[model samples]
Target: MTRTVFFISDSTGITAETLGSSLLSQFEQQKFEHVIVPYVDSIEKAQAAVEKIDRVAKESGEQPIIFDTLVNADIRAVIATSSGFIIDVLAHFLGQLETALGQKPSSTVGRVKNADRDARYKNRIDAVNFALDNDDGARINRYDQAQVILIGVSRSGKTPTCLYLALQTGVFVANYPLTEEDLEERRLPRPLAEYRDRLYGLTIEPERLSAIRSERRPNSPYASLRRCEDEVRDAEALFSRFGIPYIDTTHASVEEIATRILVETGLRGQRSQ
Candidate 1:
């Protein structure tokens, strides 16, 4: 059966959505329709949200699951009065945390503070800019500034993984594509050879690589299965020959790949600096 899930918050609703979706992932057999309602800090918005929830519950003949990060007690109370199975995501955890720490939280609304003034946010933006500047092996002179440099065959999940790491963790990341000439030569480029300690490799299965390339350039030699297989084989061999650590991205998400790279390379978030 399909269930409705609502992620509510006083701000962007990202926290509620992320936590709710992760929790829902445990029920592999269940299907869900997700709705995100953000900026529900006022009583009027809260009542409107409740009305929506009640309507869904009545129409579906079942209570929708609600995960709310709303910190205002009055808003929380209003939301709890709805027909859904309401989870006060922030209150439950923060309450216990208060007891453990012997301190009361600010109890203020999320995003009430200016994130633009945060150094972490600024650092994340800088890292994102760095990724864009150094993408696809551009501007080799900037290698020294990169925390981690990803080298991989085209369509092997290099560029996106770099950007994910940079944006999510404030890790300065760059990606270099292993082109046809480099794969054939089976040698590291002069520029990349200097940064061997920071180099990470990614390789994907031939069939998957071919399919990804086909989307970008259909019915071309570059997207051919044979070309993909050859490039993957050669890239892996180069990685092995040079002792550069690498992971297979064929079945991995960009988040997983970025995490592995950070863990393996001992990279820290630039935001923390």
Candidate 2:
């Protein structure tokens, strides 16, 4: 049976949805139809949300499950009148926190809108821009400013991993695509030699690499299995020669690759504030 699930919030419903989904994941046999109601800061919006929840309950003949992060007491009261199984996310924890801290909660909308949060957001944006600017070894001179530099053959998951580290962790990430010349020479690029300690390598299985390249350049020598095998073999050998930490991107997601890089390099605690 499919149950109606509501994720309501005064700001973006990210918090509500994240917590709600995590809880729902434990019920492996249940299916849920999710409805997100964000920006419910005012009484009118909250009342409208309640009406929607009631309508869904009436239509489905089952009480809807509500996961809420409503900060305003009036808005919360209005939503509580709906015919749903209410789960007050903030109310469950705020009282304990208030008692522990001996102070009332701020109860503000979009808590991350302060000046310090704005500065941190700006830093993340700048890191994203840096990743894009230095992609595929475009701006080699700026390697001095990079926190980590990813090196890999084409389509080995370097670009996406760099972007993930920059956007999610606010780390200054740069990527350098190893070309035929660099692979044949079996040495790191001149521009990256000084940053050897910060270098990370990505290698992919030849079959997967060939399949990925075939989608871009079909039936070409560059996409041939022979070329793919040679390139990957040479790239891994070069990484070993230089003692650069590397991972095979054969099956790892971008998040996993970025997380592994951070954990292995001890950069997880160095994220931008």
Candidate 3:
């Protein structure tokens, strides 16, 4: 049977339209014919739209699904209709509104709760996108507040590890490269030096490092085995001199590296995700 869905919203009609379009895209018409009507922007429009939907449902013998965002009288009348199912999404919105109001106004408690939730969600999407953008483990760091910072030479699996930590564990993970310049200077990057205790360095065998780089920049000096070995040794020596903790990422998967780093850094509880 063909299914018709309606999205009615008093406010954020664009949001309703966008979400409706996204939900519809998940379906293929060959298997299920579907329709999404968005932006029932007012009580009058919502009631009129319900009448139209009811007529279509009766004619087609199809039970329509109505996702309603109207929080006023029209929603009540529409819910009275018999030919379709009206889901009062506005009820949930109202519940959330009440919750927001019930908390103490102008308080850090309310602000921090909202801020942390927003940050967590934004971080997860960023992690997934970062994984896609830096698929080959290019040296990069974006999540600056990651509880567990990942330090590694180029192609030592730092990007994938940070992404996995962020996406799966919701742990903010910043990563930095132990570049030849930093190694030559016998110091960690200036930014990372401040968080010396939280830094978790990753090292890999020269041969594997060379192979991974060659795939990205073949025959270039950056991909040479000699450079890889030199950087690895220099980085390792610097870590030792600075007494910074480190990990060998030679055969570790993203999960393993993240887990080990969290565990060794005493951040198993401090960093989640």
Q: Pick the candidate with the highest TM-score.
A: 1
lDDT string, candidate 3, 13-99, tens digits: 444444454555687662333344444445566667767778878887877766654545544575456477776654666578779
Residue 118 lDDT in candidate 3: 74
Clashing pairs in 3: 146-172, 165-273, 169-272, 169-273, 170-273, 171-273
- What is candidate 2's TM-score against the reference? 0.79
Question: Candidate 3: where are CA atoms >4 Å away?
Answer: 1-144, 269-273
Please report how far candidate 3 places residue 179 from its true position, in Å.
1.8
User: Across residues 202-248, which tens digit of lDDT does each residue of candidate 1 receive?
Assistant: 99999998998999999999999999999999999999999999999
Task: Give the alpha carbon lDDT tens digit for every residue of 1-273 in model 2.
Answer: 799999999887878987898899899999999999999989999999999999999999999999999888888889989999999888879999999999999888767648877777788899999999999999999999999999988999999998889887889999998888998987888999999999999999999999999999999998999999999999999999999999999998886798899998888622443
Report, for all candidates in order, the number of backbone clashes: 0, 0, 6
lDDT minimum window of 10 residues, candidate 1: 110-119
Q: Rank the candidates by TM-score, best first.
A: 1, 2, 3
- lDDT score of model 2? 0.90
Candidate 2: count of backbone clashes, pairs at least 3 residues apart or interchain: 0
- Of the candidates numbered 1 and 3, which has the greater lDDT value? 1
Better of 1 and 2 by TM-score: 1
Residue pairs in clash, model 2: none
